[model samples]
Target chain A: AQSVTQLDSQVPVFEEAPVELRCNYSSSVSVYLFWYVQYPNQGLQLLLKYLSGSTLVKGINGFEAEFNKSQTSFHLRKPSVHISDTAEYFCAVTDRSNTGKLIFGQGTTLQVKP
Target chain B: DTAVSQTPKYLVTQMGNDKSIKCEQNLGHDTMYWYKQDSKKFLKIMFSYNNKELIINETVPNRFSPKSPDKAHLNLHINSLELGDSAVYFCASSQGAGGSLDTQYFGPGTRLTVL
Candidate 1:
């Protein structure tokens, strides 16, 4: 079993400001990590994923996440944010169980203000 | 063309009533999943099917039954809905299981309101 913990429940920032959403996971085995974004009333959209290899993973909408194995963290970052970036972000994890089931975090609400 | 679609984007029903939500995926994926998002926006997996076979049921109540007639279509039938069931239901699909790292595409989601 795996669990994801998002340290920040809400992040408020002005437009064009840099931001980081922290995520930590606890799993017995190796895992695959993912970040998803959801608009006001829309479903989730894939932001980025970390399968293997490199530690730095870049995603859409100028978002990037670094997978630190030693720290058991996959923190999402954006150099600059826009007002349109106001949304909910979720961090998920899954292992090689081949079940295709993902354990999601509590979610972090990013409020980009002007 | 929608990759993954769900019917009845919003469902409003009374308690003890039976209702069903339909989901379909045209991405030719082998795996389909159902997730529930609560009022606080907590997303949790409810069920998963692979090629018309039940693969995972995450301690959900038996009242929530999922039927997969084919690889592309998966329907959820809830018997005796409750107020706690008032949440957004999302349908998603993936190419395969874990280790593949295939992204799961999601539908628009069906908001069910049980009164």
Candidate 2:
């Protein structure tokens, strides 16, 4: 069974400040990693994903993530954030078996303050 | 157009009552899934259907039943709902199953409250 753990439950930052959301996963087999953001009362939107090639993957809204095979981590980072970036972020993983069932982390609430 | 959509964005009902949530995808995806998000914001897969065929069925209670009328629609019917069943249910769809890296598009989610 594969699982994901988000190191932080909440992260607070000021506008224009950089932010990083840590994620770690445990899987014996190959896996795909993804980051999703859910705003207030809205469906989740894909932030980024790492399928193959290039440890550094860039995503929408100027967000990016690095897939560290050795560390088994896919951390999301943004050079600067805005108040609109405040939302619940989730890290998810799915094994290569093709079940397409995502194992998600507990989610980290990103609070951006002015 | 909405890639994925769920009906009855909010549902509040009394315990022991039965309710159903409907999901549809306009993306022409072959696989659809149901996920439950608890109060604490933890999400887990409940069931999956591919081309109207059941595939992944998690260890959810038997009271929770899923029906797929076609490749584009999947509906969940809950029987004798409990307070524990009060959570946000999400519907998702993907291109294919097994080794497909296609991103699963999610619905806005149906918030169910059991009184």
Candidate 3:
């Protein structure tokens, strides 16, 4: 079994400000981690993923995340965010043997203000 | 081209009525899933299918059912719809990669309202 926990429910930041969305997980077996973004009235889009070999992973829209195995965390970060970057973000994980089913977190909403 | 698509973007129906939401993926992926997002914004997995095989069936009520005629289509049918069934349903698909590690593309969600 695998479960994900995104620490913050909402985050408010100004344009060009650095932002970080914290995520942690607990799983009994080898798992894959993913970050997804959903704009208002839109479906989710993949932001980043942690599969193997690399702790640091870069994604679209200048966003990036680091997969920390020892800490069991995959935190997303961006140095400078744009107004269009405001959206809901989700963290998900699933055990490989579980037939590709994902266990998602509660999700974090990023409110980028001008 | 749209990778994933769902029909009937909005649906409003009375209790006891039956409704279905259609979903399709053009990415040639072999895995498909149905997820529900509640009013409070919590997303939960309802079902998962791969190559027309039922894979993961969550603790969801039996009223909610998913049917996949082929790898490119996964449709959901709800019977005896109740007020509690009102929520945004999202359909997603991904490549049949081991460990469920592939990137999934999602459809614009169907906002179902059970009145």
Candidate 4:
């Protein structure tokens, strides 16, 4: 079984400020990592993912994540954030198996303040 | 066109009632999934089906049954729903189970409120 841990439950930042949402995973077999975002009263949308061939993966809305295998971390970062970026962020991991099932973290709420 | 669509965007019913949620994906994907978002906003995979075959069935209660008549549609039927069953249910689909990576596109989700 695979599990993900998001260290931050909530993150507050002003507009245009840099931010980082930490995520870690524990799995015996190989795994794929992903980050998803959900606005108020909406379904989840994929932010970025780390499959292979690249340590840094860029996603929509200027968001990116770095896959650190040694540290078992896939932290999401944004150089600058806008007010519209305020939403709930989730970190998820799926085993190398083709089950298409994912285990998600508790989620982190990013509140971009004015 | 919508990649994935779920009916009854919001469902509110008393406890012990029976209800169903319909979902369809026009993406022609072979795999579809159902995920639940609880009050804490934690998303958990409840079921996964491929080509009308059950693949992943989590520890969800038997009252929450999922039926797939075809590859493009997956419907969830809840018998005697409980208060704990109140949550946002999302339907998602991907090209295949083991593509380069499983990138699933999700529907807007149907919120269920049990009173």
Candidate 5:
């Protein structure tokens, strides 16, 4: 079984400020990491995924995450954020066992203020 | 247009009542899944179907039943709903035999509120 932990439950930032949402996972075998975003009363949308290769993976809406294997972390970062970026973010993981079952974190709500 | 869709966006019912939520995917994918999102925003997979066959059934209560009529439709029926069952249910679909490379597209969730 795999599990994900999001350190912060809420993050507040001013518009055009940088932000980072930390995520860590525990898995016995190799795994794939992903970040998803959800707006109010809407379904989740994929922000980015880390299957293999480069540690730094870029995603939509100018968001990026770096996969740190040694630290067991995949933290999502954005250099600049907008008011529209206020949403809930989830970090998920899945092993390559072909089940494609994603274990998600408790989510971090990013509040981008003006 | 709505790659994946779910019916009855909001369901408000009394305890012990039976209800069903319908899901359909037109992405031509062979696999469909049902996930529950709690009030705290923790998403968990409940059941999955591949080509109308049951594949992944989690440790959910027997009261929650998933029915797959075909490759594109998966319906979840809950019997005697409890207060703990009040949450958002999301339907998703992916391609290629449940591989990680396939991205799962999600439908606007159905919020179930049991009173």
Candidate 6:
């Protein structure tokens, strides 16, 4: 079974500031990594996913995540954030099995303040 | 147009009551999934279906039953709902099944509040 852990439960940053949401995973076999964003009272939206390619994956809304195999980490980063970027972020992983079941982390709340 | 959609955006019912949430996707995808999101923002996959066939069934309670009448519809029926069942349920669909790398599109979600 695979599992995901988000290091921070909450991250508060000012508008236009840079932010990073750390995520780590544990899996016996190769896996796919993904980052999803959810606004208040909204369903999750896919930010990005790393299947098999460059370690550094770029996503929508100017977000990016680097897949670090050695560290077992896939941290999402943004050079500059807007107030609208405040939302809950989730890190998820799924093994290369036929099921393709996703295991998600607890989630990190990013509060981008003015 | 909505790619994926769920009915009864909010559901409030008493304990021991039965309720159902409906989901549909027009993306022409063959796979659909149901996920539960707790109050603390924790998510877990409950069930998945491909081409109207059951594929993934997690360790969820038997009270939570998922039904797929067609390739585009997946419905969740909960019997004797408990307080722990009060959470948001999301429906998602992907293009393929059995290790397909297609992205899953999510519906707006149905918030179930058991009193």
The most accurate candidate by TM-score is 5
Segments of candidate 5 deviating more than 4 angstroms: none
Cα lDDT of model 1 by residue, A4-102, tens digit: 999999999999999999999999999999999999988899999999999999999999999999999999999999999999999999886778788
Better candidate number, 5 or 6, judged by lDDT: 5
Q: Considering only N, C-alpha and C atoms within 3 Å, which residue pairs clash in candidate 4?
A: none
Worst 10 residues of 6 chain B by lDDT: B96-105
Residue A1 of candidate 4: its Cα lDDT?
77
Native contacts present in each candidate (fraction)? 0.65, 0.70, 0.83, 0.62, 0.70, 0.67
Give me candidate 3's interface root-mean-square deviation.
1.9
Error of 4 at A69 (Å): 1.3
Candidate 2's displacement at residue A69, Å, is 1.4
The interface root mean square deviation of candidate 2 comes to: 1.5
lDDT of candidate 6 over A1-114, digit per residue (tens): 789999999999999999999999999999999999999888889999999989999999999999999999999999999999999999999887877688999999999999
Candidate 6 on B38-108: residue-level lDDT in tens?
A: 99889999999999999999999999999999999999999999999999999999988835366778899
Off by over 4 Å in 2: B98-100
> Each candidate: what lDDT?
0.94, 0.94, 0.91, 0.92, 0.95, 0.93
Clashing pairs in 5: none
Between 1 and 3, whose DockQ is larger?
3
Scored against the true structure, residue A36 in model 1 reaches a CA lDDT of 97
Q: How well is each residue in A1-81 modelled by candidate 5, as lDDT tens digits?
A: 899999999999999999999999999999999999999989999999999999999999999999999999999999999
> In model 5, how large is the Cα lDDT of residue A104?
97
- List, residue by residue over B37-110, the lDDT tens digit for candidate 3: 99988888888888998888999999999999999999999999999999999999988741376777899999
Clash list (residue pairs), candidate 3: none
- By summed lDDT, the worst window of 10 consecutive residues in model 2 chain B runs over B96-105
* Residue A112 displacement in candidate 6 (angstroms): 0.3
TM-score: model 4 vs. ground truth: 0.97
DockQ of 2: 0.73
Off by over 4 Å in 3: B97-99
